[model samples]
Target: MSYAPSTAAGKQTAQQLADISRTLYERGWMPGTSGNISLRLPDDPGRALITASGRDKGELTAGDVVEVDALTGLASPPGQDRPSAETAIHAAVYRVTGARAVIHVHSPYATVVAHRATATDAVTSVRVERFELLKGLGLNDPTSTDLPVFPNWPEVDRIADDVAGHLAACREGPPGLLLGDHGITTWGDSLGQAKNRLECLEALCRLLVLSQSELHVSRA
Candidate 1:
């Protein structure tokens, strides 16, 4: 699972991916092998360097990186171990959105909020307004942004399709979505940006939950 060598672009190298995973794990966004991250190879846009499946993200190392084709969903360099089971969802996202990196996490806030929305078919879209942190999302004008939430499905193909459809309908900046009762999926132009977006999303979800609870207590 160790990378052969560092590449020129500095994006596809194994160490970079490992570092990003460890950072996310420390932030508590990924716990108990509950997340995956991938960055597109800078030289070969058609390939991605991703974290291997079921590894403890907190202890991720260079040996945990694997290369896979972005188009065919096949691991490259032949004989390498399989990427994460959710690789299909990642590949589908890259194909539809042209994002350079994807981060999926089962953070507590996102999981709770998603679970609350599980009873319905319509996406639970969250709109964050009047919060200075909203600026972190990089929306076109920063007025307000609707973050779409999709229903969770066991099949990757179905989940990918719903995600793709939501992104297409929204047609806005750096689209990210949540899977009901599952987790959050976010992307950006690079690994850093993607990580930043995930952080913002998780924080916003926490704030939303807290605000609602406070309102309920005040009313009672």
Candidate 2:
């Protein structure tokens, strides 16, 4: 799919997004075409810069970013390679949280926890608490927040609505979200903060997995 040319500033922002995408991809957070990243234009609050559809996260280019109407989720210079299929979900997150940037990736830890939680047939959300990494989320303590995980929906719009509702209902939780057997979505006031929060969540998940290991040994 082809994407329309972005404005000078948009191109710059797109480069930044592309850079972050590559970094995250190298870190194994967003592999293949399994993740999306977006940010609101610095000057215009209603326009968002999002990754074009199906582009490899590891080799993202400025052209891989498309400008879309924040509220309507429509591409600016309309064409193929339309914004990520999950653009609506990112838009919903921005509108609901007043955040300027959002990152959604399918990492192993988040996917496993989300899937594990789903298998229990209990609640749809996953909680990570009492870890020192909690401070990475800018929290005073672990009890202050939980990651909200929602079941993936075939209809993207419905998933977006559910995310919006969850954000509304839980004002204290971290900005990270998980789609069961899908991936994790996180955002913040800026691109840096958004990426930071993503790293924090990923690190927390890794620690959680490690903490569960009880290696038995006998003194030699």
Candidate 3:
């Protein structure tokens, strides 16, 4: 839960997160300070650097990150800036998947699909099959897979609990999960790989939305 005072704040890793944050913000996926990103320390996977809460993603600097204990999601070596409220979700992903980086964003299409697919108290899922972008998700069977969508609970730690349970049960799951009425969270071996997976999943969601629109028009 807590770590000893770390002398270094992982400035290099924070800078990398800041760079990715700016890029995602420019793409309109991380508008305002609506999303968070985290990267595990290369030498110490138990601890990670997450973007500081309430900071504009577009304007983040290397100092804009808080190092946290991955297992407990607490700011270790506590700093003035707090970690994002959704740090629990990132921690769950790392704990369950052994991913080195995690990215959460409010990209519109993914958000739309998540809302559309969510119709029950229990978590719902949308499946994409035979899409070329499926390769980007690193699934063993690229032709088909289901993306789980969880309700946007007011308490974020509850959502993280669901994520950890789902991922642990489905070892070969897709690279990402969607939070209904919220956004998408993705993870991978590296930040760049995670970013690429986000792009691929967002595009797939866009295509799914467009196809549904076409179906409605045809029925009309």
**The candidate that achieves the highest TM-score relative to the unseen native structure:** 3
Ranked by TM-score, the better of candidates 2 and 3 is 3
In model 3, the runs with Cα more than 4 Å from the true position are 1-9, 213-220
TM-score of every model versus the real structure: 0.87, 0.88, 0.92
Structural RMSD, model 1: 4.3
* Candidate 2 local Cα displacement, residue 108, angstroms: 1.2
lDDT of prediction 1: 0.76
| Candidate 2 ranges with C-alpha deviation above 4 Å | 1-6, 119-123, 140-144, 213-220
lDDT of 3 by residue, 104-172 (tens): 999999998887876446677787777799999999989978898887888989989988998998887
- lDDT (Cα, 0-100) at 127 in candidate 2: 58
Q: Rank the candidates by lDDT, best first.
A: 3, 2, 1
lDDT of 1 by residue, 151-214 (tens): 6777777777776666666677445777778888888888888888888888877887888753
Measured with C-alpha atoms, the lDDT of residue 157 in candidate 2 is: 94
How close to the true structure is residue 42 of candidate 2, measured as C-alpha lDDT? Answer: 83
Prediction 2 global C-alpha lDDT: 0.78
Write down the lDDT of every candidate, Cα atoms only.
0.76, 0.78, 0.86
